[model samples]
Target: MTPSTSTNLTRIVKFGKKPAKRDARNLKLSAILKAPPRLPAEYDFDVQHNGIPTPMFGNDYHGDCVIAGRAHQTLRFEDAEQKKILPITETDVLKEWHLENGGTEDGVYVLDSIKLWRTKGWKAAGKVYKIKAFAEIDRKNHDEVKSTVYADIGTGLGFSLPDSAMTEFNAGKPWALTTKPPNKKNGHYVYVPGYTKIGPVCVTWGRKQQMNWAFFDKYCDEAYAMIDAADTKKKKSILDGKKIDEFLTKLKK
Candidate 1:
C-alpha cells in the first residue's frame, strides 16, 4: 500500500525489493567462514535525502516508511485549508522534494547533511540540529507452554532483525506488536518475516551461542578477512557489537 502523508506526518517508509541491492554485509559471519554472506544482507535502502544513506528501493516502488520523529516538525499547512494539512501523494515526487529541502515532501526526515551548525553558546541558536532514528532488536514472546518444550529449539537472541526482515516486521502486522515494533524474546530481538523462512536450513540443538557460532562458522574466513582488511578505523568498529549500537544510535539521534 502507498504511504498516506498529511501535515501531521513527518516521514514516509516502505519495503520492497530493489534491482540494485544495498551494501550491508555481515563481516562477523564472513570472518570465521570462508564464504561471504550476501551483500546488503537482507535490507534495502531508498530514503530520499541530500547526503544521508537511504534505502535503495527496488523498481516495485513500494510505499516508503515514514520516519516518525523530527521529520514531522517540518510539516507545512495549506493556505486553502488551515485546519487540514496537505498530503504527499507521490513517492517519487516526495523523494525529489526530500532531496532539495532537508526533509521529504511527505515530511520524512531526509537531511542532506549533518553538521554542528553552532559552535558554542547556551541559547537554542547555538544548538546543532539533526534527525536520528533507531530500531532495537526484540523478539515476540512465545507461550510458556511452547517455551518449555522448545527451549532449545529456538533461542531468540540476536541484536537486530536481518535488514531484509525489518520491512515486513515493521509493517502493522499481527506479529509486529504495537508497543514494541520489532518485538523481543528472551534477551534477543526477533522478527520472523516471510523471507527468513527461505534459502537455507540446518539442524541444530545448541543454544544462542551455538546458533551464532554455527552460522558464522560457515563463513568465518570471509567475515574475518573483511574485518582484517578494513582500511579505516571506522569500518573496524562494525565488528564490535557495542560500537555498532553506538554508531546506529548516534545516526538516529
Candidate 2:
C-alpha cells in the first residue's frame, strides 16, 4: 500500500498534544512493574460493549486530543475492570482542556496533563476520577508497550504525526510508516487499549485506529501507563498482584 497523497489534509482533524516534555520526577515503568510476566501475542481491553459508543470527546471541534485521550482511556478501563462505563461527556473534556490550555485552543503538554490527572482528577457523571500514578514508558520498546496493554493499564501516547496520517485516517486505514518525515509541530495524543498482530490499536477522533509497529516506532514520542485508582481499589486488578501498593509507598518517600 502507498502513503496517502493528500498534503493539504492537515486540518482534517484537531491535534491538541503539545511537544513532549521530560520530567525528572516521573516514575519509570520498569521500576514499578518489575519482572512482568510474558505477554500474549495479542491482547485488547477496548472491547466493544452492547451500548457504548466510542466518543470523540470534543476532539472534532477543539484541540483537546490530550484531554480526549484521558477520557477514552477512562472509558476503556472502567468498562474492562468495573464492567460499567462512566458517563464522561464532551463538556467534561472541554472543561478540563480549558483549564489546562488557559481557555485557549493551544495544546497541552502530555506530562502536565497526566500530572493534573493524578492530583486534581477529572469530573464525570457527578463523580471525580483520579489515577493512582502514571509511569513513563519507552516509546521505542514494543514489548513494553504491548505488556502495558496486556496488564490492563491503559496507555496514553503522544505522537509527532506525519502529514500523510491525515489522509490515511480520512480513508479509514491503519497508520503505517511512510517515507514522509514526522511533523513535530503536529503533535497529537491517543489512548491505546489493545494490540493485535499488526500492531497497537489506539482510539482517536472518536474511532478505533490501528497502526503498525513501524508507524508506532517512527511517530510515538511519549508514552505512559496509568494506574487507575478504581483498579487499585479492586483487588482483582492485575496490578494488585504486582504489589503496586508497596511500590507506591516507596515512591512517597
Candidate 3:
C-alpha cells in the first residue's frame, strides 16, 4: 500500500528485512575492537564527499531492502575511502537480491545477507565487491554505533518499524520514539553511514533518514559493522593485525 504525504505525494516503500537470526559463531564488535577511538560529538559521512543522490535500488517496488542497504553501504565506503563512487544500479541490486533470496520478493535475514556479502560478494558496475568481515554491534550502545560510523566502518541496521514511520519519512522528519507499536512484519534494513548529534543518519528509500537514539534503541534489533575488503587492503584500523587474523580464523571454521 502507498502512503500519502502532507503534499499528497504518494510514497511507495517496501520493507524486506526479516527478524535477526543468531549463531554462536558470529563475531562480536566488543571482542574485535577492545577500545574504539573517541569521536567528535557530531559527525556525518555524507558531508565528507559529493556523491550522487542516494538511489532506491528497486526498493520502491520490491522487498529488497537487504540488498539495497548493501548497495548503499558500498557507495558510502567507496566514496569515503576509495575516493570514487561505484556505479551501482537498481538492476544490479535486484540481481543480487534474486541470487541471495532465491528469486523471491520475500524478505531476508540480516545474518544470511552478511554471510553472502562476505563469501559470494555482490556484482555492480561489472565488478565484484566483497567485505573482509562482519561483526555484530551492540545496538543499545549509542556510543558504539557512533564510533563505527566515525571510523568509516560500514553499518547496517535491521529494525521493526512502526506504522507512523511512514508519515514521518514522507514528511522528511527525523524518526523519534512514538506511542505507536512496532510491527515485526514491517522489518526493514538500512545502511547508516553517518550520524549527527540527534542520532544516526540512515539511507533508505533513496533519502537520508535521521532517527533519534531513543527511537533507535527501541526498534533497532540488529546492527552490524561490515569491514570492506578495500578498507582492509588500505590498512584501515577496523581491527589490529592480530585481531583480524583471529577473526578471520574463526570465520573459516
The 0-to-1 C-alpha lDDT of every candidate, in the order given, reads: 0.21, 0.79, 0.81
Of the two candidates 1 and 2, the one with more favorable lDDT, higher being better, is 2
- In the range 1-253, model 2's lDDT, one tens digit per residue, is 1111222444346777888899876777766665556677887775544455678787767878888899888876677667788888999999988998888768899999999898899887677888888888987678878878877777999998998888788887999957889987778999998899999999888788999998988888999999885244322334443555666677768
Q: Between 2 and 3, whose lDDT is larger?
A: 3
User: How do the residues 1-253 of candidate 3 rate in per-residue lDDT, one tens digit apiece?
Assistant: 2211112367887888888798877887777674666678888778877654699898888888889999988887777666888888999999998897778777888899899899888898788988888888888788778777877778899988887788899888999956788887778999998888899999999899999988898888899988875244323454555676687886678
Pull out the clashing pairs in model 3. Answer: none
Q: Please tell me which predicted candidate would have the highest lDDT against the true structure.
A: 3
For residues 1-253, what per-residue lDDT tens digits would candidate 1 score against the true structure?
1222111132232321111111243212222222222332221111111122112221113222221111121111111113333232334333433443345222221111111111110111122223221111111211211121111111112221233222322332222212232211111111111112111111101100112222322221110010112222423333333544455455557
Query: What are the clash counts of all predictions, listed in order?
Result: 46, 0, 0
What is the TM-score of each predicted model, taking all chains together? 0.20, 0.87, 0.91
lDDT of 1: 0.21
TM-score-superior candidate, 1 or 2? 2
